[model samples]
Target: MSEKINVGDKAPDFELIKPDGSTFRLQNQLKETNVVLYFYPKDNTPGCTKQACEFRDQYEVFKEHEAEVVGISADSSDSHDEFERSHRLPFVLLSDTGNKVRNLFGVPRKFGIIPGRVTYVIDKDGIVRYIFNSMTKPLEHVKNALEVLKNIEKK
Candidate 1:
């Protein structure tokens, strides 16, 4: 794996495909708002569903703070589309094929198999403000990201 991106490091810019097949560039997004970039394992899974719903539930609050919630997974665009429509997820879900972007962010695998559950809070300037990595406590990612976005807003 590449060197893990830390709190103070600049978030690496990457391009991925959204469920609608539109391209999503990280740097381009940072120009408009802070990004809550999350990498989950799969679509329609138990833990991933809960985490996405949590973000969906608090999405307006994130928007109030000028942050955008984005989810990434190795799943295909079709799967992401279904997940979003099924749960009514308001944020964007990008398809990270081959785990390229996940590797770019250095998200580790749990026990060398499952993809890591990690959330990164990147400020408007593209600096990573916070990183929460926890495979077991998936719901905590949303809470922690909101807290970080709040702190970033205060600054």
Candidate 2:
């Protein structure tokens, strides 16, 4: 794993298959609005479910601000589909089956886990404005991202 990106750093671009079977290029898909890219260890687990549901609960607000949420993991698209269905998620769940995006973002991968809980908020310009790593109380992660986006809205 490389160094974790800092604020204002350019976010790495990658292509992942969308749930609808379309290929999604990170930069291209995010050209119109802010992008909330979060990496988790896996889907269908307790911590991961809590974090994803928190985002789902706040998803409408994120959409209202012209932002889209994407959850990534080494899990297959099938697993993601199951998670989204079971949780009624309203956003895209991307598959990083090869761990390419995980490595590109320098998400910590240790302890036999695919990736640690890391969230990055990328603005329309493809710059990372915030990154949060914590599974406990994951709502704080979404709150921080919204704060940044709200501040940007003020600008």
Candidate 3:
């Protein structure tokens, strides 16, 4: 794992493949809005499903705060596509097949086995304002991210 970043640290830049086979660059998205970039273990799993659905349901709230919620996983583009479509997720799901972005953010694995479930709240200036790491409380990810974005907007 790479060095863990702090709250005020500049978020590392990365590019990953989206569900449609297009590239998603972090720098470009950060230019317009804050990003709720979440790294999950897999697609269609129970915890991941609940997490994604929570993000989907609260997606409009994120948009109201001028934040973009994005999910990243090592799942392939086809799996991502199916997951998005099946779940009716309103946000973008990136295919981080190489786990490069996960390592870039130093998201640790659970028990040195499963991939970590981490959520990062990054501002438009590319600073990481908050990070929530939890393997069980999946719904809390959406709630915490919204809270952080609201606080950031107040500043």
lDDT of 3: 0.93
Candidate 2 matches the true fold with a TM-score of: 0.93
Writing each residue's lDDT as its tens digit, candidate 3 over 1-155 gives: 79997799999999987877688999999999999999999999999999999999999999999999999999999999999999999889998888889999999999998999999999999999999999999999999999998999899
Residues 37-123, model 1: lDDT tens digits: 999999999999999999999999999999999999999899999999999999999988788889988999999999999999999
Give the least accurate 10-residue stretch of model 1, judged by summed lDDT: 14-23
Backbone clashes in model 3: 0
- For all candidates, the clash counts are 0, 0, 0
Q: Which residue runs of candidate 3 sit more than 4 Å off their true CA positions?
A: none
In terms of lDDT, the poorest run of 10 residues in model 3 is 15-24
Clashing pairs in 2: none
For model 2, how does the per-residue alpha-carbon lDDT over 1-155 read when each residue is reduced to its tens digit? 66778889999889999777999888896778899999888898888898899999999999888899989988888899999999999999999888888888888865756468889999898989899887665677788888888887787
